[model samples]
Target: MARPENVKFGVLGKNIGYSLSPKIHKAVFEVLGIQAEYDLINFSKTDLSKADIDEIKHQYKGFNVTIPFKEKIMPFLDEVTEDAWKIGAVNTVRVETKGLVGYNTDYIGFRVSLERAFDWPIESAIVLGTGGAAKMAVAVLKDLKVRTIFTVTREKGGILGTQTLSYERLEALCPRTDLLINATPIGSVQYKDQMPISEALLKKQKGVFDMVYVPEKTKLLQLAETLNIPRINGFNMLLIQAVAAESIWLERELDVMALVEAIGPKCK
Candidate 1:
């Protein structure tokens, strides 16, 4: 079958009025010479039902899912890619003849950004949450051959492939962690002045990656920088993931970093 004549794409999530997706994707479509429209569709899980999903399938060619809905949107999908299935979340989805197909571009985005941020290989990492974002981060870290991946959460322990630790245990494990990642929303611009780990503990790690991008410089990343540890914010990850999702919807590959560099100023 041929591609849709006029592709209509957007992102699905709550509190997305500040999303840069519309601008980034619109720029991409222009460069690719494709006719498309990208927008933001904000709504919580309660606001959508089977009927609403059916309406969306009729109205949209594809759309990206974001925070608070990556996992909640799974039941409505007809098919999910292996990576998305393994990660237990879906950030990108397409309306297929059968139904909707889901995929997780977060993995690609995080992995590529990780490569660009670090010259040397990572041996171990401490993922700072067990939510959908953490799952994607853990998946990429494992694929990159990070020998040990420890997941931490506030509640019960033991998640992913490693034992989960509380916030207190980080002090003891920081010495052995090569990379520390914040996959939680604790440090988001919405929830400011929050740091997942203490500055002292963050100093022990060789590097840090924070998955919060709204403020561009999250508290976690700021703390990492204060400690002189090489740190990366999720802004690049955000742009790269949007690029990945567009590639999936277009069914073609584009230069990831080239696109990133092209959209550099806007991303910041």
Candidate 2:
């Protein structure tokens, strides 16, 4: 027998055929014993610009946003949490009578995962890409007291108001970078075996964190492993953030460990 949709939830993104979010959330719901449905609301880049957020509010109680849509979905939201507002990205949205409210848990996830993965002091970091995830990464890195933060993007000039640099500059800055984070989709499932930065540059960092978890070990993390640099994948970050979002949607804290045990393996 199939369960009726007592509660609704999902993720919104473009080209998300490989997303494991459904599995992760479903597992969380199961462990928490909540009857809900999680689905993928796929949209093309062209479609995202003209997204009908009203339809979303009518359909879901809460939802997760991803990729190009993370920042693009903001204008459609009625209110954004302080962290989301500061980061200029919203990965989670809760529907209320006041309209849709946006929140960004990527920062919490990134911060928690880093604390578990490394104990050394981080004075500086080089973050790749300038998307919503990158913004969250920068925020968390700054919170960790990383004074010098550098962002690398393909854009020739400024990106999201951060001091941006071209990929060409990465090689030179890598030596001085204590931590390197890949917040782009460059090493995603579609771009398998691709690295955001060069292997030589990657070797210079004391630690590397790649926010793409689909493959579990992105090429960037693989390169870090080869160089003996401490590396952490995005799986823990994804799980932690997803759990945090669920807590917000349900208005209560969830049994995170139970959900992690159930969905952690599926993320890989």
Q: Per-residue alpha-carbon lDDT of model 2 for 78-182, expressed as tens digits?
A: 899887898889999998878899999877788889898989888878888887888888888767777778888887644443568889877765556778888
Q: Residue by residue across 161-204, what tens digits does model 1's lDDT show?
A: 87678877766666567898888888775688887777777777
Q: What's the TM-score of every candidate structure?
A: 0.91, 0.92
Q: In model 1, which runs have C-alpha deviations exceeding 4 angstroms?
A: 44-48, 171-175
Model 2 clash tally, residue pairs: 0
TM-score of 2: 0.92
Task: Give the worst 10-residue stretch by lDDT in candidate 2.
Answer: 43-52
lDDT of each: 0.83, 0.83
